[model samples]
Every structure is written in C-alpha cells, then in structure tokens.
Target: MTTSKKHGSNTALVHSDYQAPEGFAAFPVGIHHASTVLFKNVAAMRERSWQNKSAYTYGLHGTPTSFTLEARLAEIEQGEHCLLVPSGLAAITLVDMAFLQSGDDVLIPDNAYNPNRELGDWLARSFGISARYYDPMIGAGISDLIRDNTRLIWAEAPGSVTMEVPDIPAICDAAHAKGVLVALDNTWSAGVAFPAFDYGVDIIMQALTKYQSGGSDVLMGAVITRDQTLNARLQAAHMRLGFGVGMDDAYLVLRNLPTLKLRFDAHDASARKVAAWLQTRPEISKVLHPALAECPGHEIWKRDFTGAGGLFSVLFDARYTEEQTDRFVDALQLFKIGFSWGGAHSLCVPYRIKQMRQHWSHDGILVRFNIGLEDAEDLINDITQALESLDA
Candidate 1:
C-alpha cells in the first residue's frame, strides 16, 4: 500500500502506511486470515473469482494458507484438486449433496463409518434419493447391486472398527463400467498408506483431524479429485454450503504434515506388535487388523494397501460378556477410552459390532485400539493389566 495524505488517528491505525519488506523466506507457510479481502479498485474486484485460486474473492473461498494446505494435500494424494471443510463428515456431506439429487441412488458399505452410514440413511429417509447398503466384500459383485439410477458409490478402504479391507479395484472397475462414480474414505490411510486414485476412485475424502493434525487438536477434512469437471461440481457445492475452515486449523494440519509419514510408520509398527501379541492370547478370538492374517479381507489389503497405520480392533473371546469387556477397557491406565485416532496418545473404543453392521458373523465383543507413539512393550503391558480386570 502507498502512503496517502495524513488522516485521523482511527483511519491511520486501520490503514497503516508501513509495509513489510517483500523478500521474506520461511519454512512454514504464512497464515493468511481474512474475511473481507481488499482490492485496489472495482476493476480488480471484478476480475477476482472464488473458483480461481490464483486470486482471492472472500475468506470462505480460501486464503493463501488454506490454498497452500489444499495444494499440498492434493499432491500427497496424487490428486489435482482439493476442497477443505469443517469436519470429515462435512467432506462426506459435500460429495453427497453435490452429486446425488432427488431420484438418484447411492450405495454405501454396510460397515462404513457410522456417521457415513447414518448420512446415507438420512438422505434416503428425508430426500427422494435411494440409499442402500452393500456388503464390503461384494467386490465386482457390486455391479449387480448398482441400479440404473445409482449415481454414487461410497467405499472405505477397510470398513471402520471391524477392519475388513474391501477390494477397491474390483469395486471401482464395476462402478466405472456402470458409469458410476466411487468415493473412498481414505482417512484410515491418511493418503500415506493407500493411493485411492490409482485404484480408480473418483473422489477421496480425508479427515485431516487424525493423522494430518497429529495433535488430535484440529477438526478439518478435505475432498480431493483429479477430474476437473468433478472438482467443479464439488466447488459449486462447497460455495453453496458455505463450508469454510479456520485458518489456524489449516496451519496446524500443514505444520504436522511434514512428520505425518514418520508418525504413521511408528504407529504401524507398534500396532502390529500389539495386534500380533493379541493373536496368541486366549482372551482374543480375532484381531481385526488389515495387516493380520485373521482379519477379514487381509489378502485384499496386502494387494492394494502399502501400509496399515495405527488403528486396529480385537474381539474378546465369546466367554467374556459386554460388561466384562467394558471393565477391561476401563481398567487400562495408559490407553485412554475415546473415539477417533491418529495422535500421540493411544485410545481404546468398544463397539457393538452386530448393531453397527447389517450382518456380523463374529461372536465376541469388539474393542478397537489406536496405537500411539508409546513403547510397544508398555502398551502390551497396559493391555495385560486391563485383561486381568475382565475376570475381576
């Protein structure tokens, strides 16, 4: 900004003549927060468009901070575009609202993240849309389920909690053949373990709240796509929904991204150790970890995923009642009881598998583990003590 004639103190304070030098360099991306961006003149304002990331129109569209984060996320996921929203579920909502209209049909995995399944149910109940659930293991068999009205299919690399890895390629192939678009909840892999695009997924939704934030402090989500036309549709929905993320949260996710893979690998190693140990225990009937042989669709995981991060679940022997299993969860000292994962602190959550799924063949109480950066032995010891509580 150039200096103008001296004005009142209030005006001077609001429009400072001092401008910082331009040649600043830093490792961190600068946080640019602005609700009302200024333009030199009406001409400049008229030229700026929200869809054009090269310039800014308003805060809701995006500032430099959010643009940088989106660009980096897109690059990491091997996608061409990305849109940020307030929460992971919001990202799912954006895709749903953008693509599926009245009279459209959508297919969701029976074991998808509960909120996703709930959203599908809500769409079906409230809107004219037809939302249906399919078995995660359906693979190419999903082709038979896709109706002529089907517009979208939602896939989770591995169904939440139960940890059954789906055959993404087969599902994608079938969906593509039927002229349907497939969207994957790639939050489990954090774009580090699974490359959704390579497997033919049309859209990728990530919960930056988890691994990307690393501190478990931020709540944000991103939707990425390689097709410009598809991205245009998402951007239109984003604008209409007014989905804007806080600049500070965007910066936090940006800061931790550098160490995301490192933390993910550490978590992976510890989880594998803990899961493998549980496999030998008499108390555990199954360890629902994609990397483990006992996990459903383990072979599919091996074929598609490059890595399995910290999250996994274990089923207590049928002999243990829900009350006893709850006692075991409460007995743990180090692993705090909570929902969500991907932070330095380990978390444990128990799920009524039968209630969550349309069909559950397993016969035991399920407890999920989010292994953190803690020592593998220490986590194992904590579980040991917690296991003793089941008998108490």
Candidate 2:
C-alpha cells in the first residue's frame, strides 16, 4: 500500500508504514543495531564507502534507523541535514572538532552548559585552539570579541543556571556578517520552542536526552544544519569520530517526537505558573524565566522564541543561608534533587554561579528548577512546604 497524501501529525502516528517491505511481511522500522552493513555488490560497496547520507557501509557511518531519526529531526529543525552523536556533549565536541583547527578561536557564552565550556578550555590547552567567554546578553556586541582567527560562535538561549535568554538573531546576524559560523546549543528550546535555522543559525545542536526523549532514559544528540556544505563537513567529522547513537535510543526519540509540541506547551504553562509562584515567596529574590516579564532577556525571548520550556532558575533572598537552602531542598517530597531536566519528574538543584563563571557574579544562592508533568497544584504545595521548611 502506498501513502499518497501528506501525512498529518496524527496520521504519522497511526501509519506504521515507516519501514521497508520484506518478502512476505512488512518489518516495522524497529531497532537496527549494526556495526558492519553488508553491501549488495563490490560496486555498491565502493559507492557506499563515502559518507554522503545515502547508503550505509559501516555502523558508525549510520544505519537505516539512525537515518530515519536524522531525517525526522531535520524536518523538525527545518534544516537541510542532520547528524547524530552519542550524546549532546559529543554533538558540541563534533561541532568544535569539525570547524576549529589549531590556532583558531571560538567564542562561547559564559553561561553555556558547563561541559561545553570546559571542553572548549580543554581543547584550547590540548589542541592549541582558543575559546573566549562572552556575556550571554552581549547580542550584537559579540562582534567586539571576534578575532581574525575566530571560526565559530556558540550561543545558548536562556543560558544554563542563570536562565538568561540571549538575543539569538542579533548574534547570528553579527556572526554571519564576518563569515564566521554560528552554532547554538538549542537544548533549552528543544527546536520546537524556537527554530534556530529560521533565526539564521548555520548549525543547530540539540541534546535529545532532554525534551526530545521526554523521559530520563535516553542519551542522544543531533547537529542540524541548513547549509549542505557545512552538513557535509560535520558528517565527515562525526564519521571520523565514530560518534553514533544507539538504535534503541533513536527509536525512543522518534516515538516521542510525535508528542513533542504538546509536551512543550504543557511544560511552558506549568513552568510559568511555578515561576510566578516562586516570585511571590518572600525568600525568593528573583525568578529567572525567559517567559516571565522580569527575566533578564524577556524582551529578546519575546521577540524571537515562540515558547519556553520546563527549565528555569530562582534566586533566594540574601538573608537565606546555605543551610536554609539545603533544608528547603531536602524537604521537597515531589521535586527530586538531581542533574538534567526535561524528564517526566520534577527536579531541583542548588547552583553556585561564582564557581561556574569568571566574568559574572551573583550574590544570592540560585536554585534551578525543572517543572515536570505532575499536577500543578501538587508542585505548588511541594514548593510551599519546601519554603516553609526554610523558615522553620
């Protein structure tokens, strides 16, 4: 049976025809775990040797299941191509490895995911490449940091810990003017919240382990690009590094992709409610959420992004001590203290900005919150009790 019309969102879910046909029965496009793929002939083998996104010769190159996931992700990002990696950090590293060489410079926001920033610093020390930290709110002012050797600029919206939303379009415009490539760690927005390619980002990287998987089980990342040339280069780098995600992980993300928009909207609503409630607490200094009117980059986020996600941060009043913060966290029955968000269960982590940055400083104790799918009333009650614990 051939599907002629364009499949709608629900149609895609109902139609299990995404797989190829076998002799008598249709094999569902399940997990295709492979390291070495067999070719039809020597001619086909020679043709498949090159990593051009067509035929797969090796497992590290890609399997049919991986290709399907990549295609679906590219469609979601509205990009010309997409490449999968073992993890989100691997995706960041692949972008750095593919674009930067010895003596080249890359610009990273001070509020970037700590791992990416650390990787850049390590690369600078080990590979002779240099990475300079810029303020997340710099916007077009990033031009001042661009050097002749600058090859790439990394941007993260609603940056980690601080939750400051950057002026992504302004940064992209400035970077493109200098012929320097712009790559965004778009895990916060999950591609559904904000379309990076539409905003002029040459390369878009996402950690599927977060919102894309919707569960805390899978670890995956993707590098999407609108430029075919840049895509080719990234694919070559991915191939060389043998960076490939598990077929099961790919299947999990693919299954979750159908409900991504709905989940994102739910997260946005729940997060706004929680952030607003946190603001009313006397012990809370500020609520760092992009969708909120008082956030650092509310105007920019309003102008660029279509929505927000579950991730946001809160600063406690200066009067609160570390012991108080610990007591509050320990009192929470619903919010688990853990790393990584975009999962089904809510989580909270107290962070020290002084340790995370060199150029920036915040005086109050900051706690990042990840709102989950639980009832908003329950979450609110949990917070209320947790805050009460702080007072007692």
Candidate 3:
C-alpha cells in the first residue's frame, strides 16, 4: 500500500499527480464531474478559447460529461452548437439576455409559456428592454410587428396551453427578412418532433428534464444553434449566468436519450387516443391537439411537424366551471395532478386562459394533460372513470 506520509503529508499528496488509466471503455459515457480543471502547462491554458468550447477552462463553462451531452443534443437538434443551462427557462432568458439590451425590443407569442410571458412582463420590462406579444398565427404577417430596435422574436409551437400551432416558417422568414433572430421555446416537442432549424429558426431551446431525462427528476435545459456566431453570444451569456448542470443529472439525461424516440412515440399514440376519446364525450367542448384537425393551425402542424407529443389541452363546456375541472383532474387516478410533463407518469394541469391569449375567444374551462408511457387503453379507462366526477 502506498502511504502519502512516505513522501509528505496526506493532504499535500492528495493533490499530487496520479495518472488515470489510458484505455478505458464503457457503453455509458463516464461522468467527469470537475471544477478548476488543471492544465498541462500555463501556455496550454492560454491558447484555449473557452467561448468556442475548443478546450475546457473551468467547471462552470464545460466538462467532458457536459460537453458530451451538448454534442449529442446539438446533433439530435440538427444544430452545430449546443449550450446547457440550469433550466429550460434559463435557456430562454439566456437568449434574451445575450442578444437584446436596454432600448431593444423582443417579440414573444401571446400564448408563449407563462414564465416566458413573465420574463417579458417583469425582468425584460424592468431592464428597459421591451417585449411585445404578437399573434403567433400571424406568420409572415409578423413583419408588421418588427421595429428598428426589434432584436429578437420568440415563437412557441402550438402556443402554450391553448395548443394553437403557429406558422413557424412564415414567422422565421419574416424575422430573417428584418434581420432579427427567432428563438423558439421548443419544450413541447423536445426539439425532436419539430425541426426548428428546418423552419429557419435561429435558436431552439429544450427542457431536457422532460423527455430527455424521462424520469421527471432532472431539471436541465439546452440552447442549440447552427450558427457559431450566435452560439458565441449565447455561451457568453451562459457564463455570466453561471449556469451548469449536476453530473448525475447530465448522466441521467444521457442514459435516457436512447429511449427518447420510443417514449415519445408511445406518448404520442396514447395522447391521440385520449384526445380522440375526449372529443366524443359530452364533457369536452373542444380538444386542442395539434394532431387533431379541429385544432387551429393543425394543417400547418401537419405540414411542418413530423409528429406531435402528449402535451395538449381540452376546453370544457361553459357549464363546467373551474371547480368542475379541478374535480375532474383530482379524480384522475393514473394521471396525477401536476405541472410540467415528459415522464413515466401521466399529469393533469388546469390552465387559466383568461389572460393567456389575445386573439382567441374561449370562456370554457381549459385542462392540459401530459400522457406518459402508459397503455392507451388503460389511460382511456382512467379518463372514463374520472369524467364521472364532471357530472357531480
């Protein structure tokens, strides 16, 4: 046994050099949790570009574990660069903080994620950077909203809880024509089902804690871009925010990536079944699923999105108040009442729609459901039993 005391104190030898094995192989990537990465020499560190991710500078910037995850996410998202953040909203804020500044304006969909709306309503506004809510369906019509100070435009597919799919290509085209960037909150599809770059989207952000983690345990996010120049700005903002993910969380997301497609397909299949069944019931006045024809922009979704995920909403008749919707969600056994989605367990959330949209007109109760990796028949039966509560 080697004793540190033979040469010096244990603490002194603890930081001493010990070479790692050269030839290591594993099916799963090793989690290289690190901080204060050491350099072979001062010159080696001096030559590296931390912003470019050409080499590691420190833990908050990048590590092998995190870089590996970033590369995989970029490849999957069809982008050339990837940056990880602590949460999905963090990614969104990063894009905003990076590109826009005081006196500049950002355009967000009226139905974007509520937190995103709050970002504009509070932080962005407080900073003197303005955010204007635009109708997502405006598509090429979005050009009218552009101003000389418009630095960025935000788009959310199937805008938030209402599930109204937007014309992404048209919106992106308009933004590009005005020399502005488009950032899409692609958490709904996990950046897989809908190809953001294909539609000319400059940046795509995903909540990896969802489908990518598959456990509902991790809360990580990623921002991907095909342009190196844009990513440089994003990386700078990310560093400023001191955003980083846990090694365990990164490993969990990495391990689950292989099963993402399978889980996504299952969730899609089951959700369609539930959505279709809900359409037939007297309780549901409308089913706002992108896969379904009745949903606004369904044709555009069919045209652009290769497939849809399990997250969607339903409009109950005016007779059923918020109280009724709450009862229905509570009565659900297999589908737990919660927020956020993309997990093994199904979830139900009641959306407050009074202030979410500007163009849509709906006074009925809105309920969102996240279908999980459960049997379609079993989930349908669960809904059937839960619907009974709507009557009482």
Best by TM-score: 1
Writing each residue's lDDT as its tens digit, candidate 1 over 278-310 gives 999999998999998888899999988889999
TM per candidate comes to: 0.98, 0.92, 0.96
Residue 293, candidate 2: how far off, in angstroms?
1.6
Alpha-carbon deviation at 314 in model 2, angstroms: 0.3
Model 2 weakest 10-residue run by lDDT: 19-28
Give the lowest summed-lDDT range of ten residues in model 3.
Answer: 1-10
Candidate 3 local lDDT, 264-380, one digit each (tens): 888998899989999999888999999999999999998998778889999999898788889999999999988888999999998878866666677698899999988988999
Clashing pairs in 3: none
Instruction: Estimate the TM-score for candidate 1.
Output: 0.98
Off by over 4 Å in 3: 1-5, 16-18
**Candidate 2 structure quality by residue, lDDT tens digits, 1-392:** 66636778788777756566576544346688998787898998887655677677888877888899999899988887889898899999999999999999999999999999899999899999999999999989998888999999999887977988998889989998898999999999898878888888889999999999999999889999988789879978987887877888898998898889899889889998999998898889889999888889999899888999899998899899989998999999999999888888999999877888877666688899999999888999999988988879
lDDT against true structure, model 2: 0.88
Q: Which pairs clash (backbone N, Cα, C closer than 3 Å) in model 1?
A: none
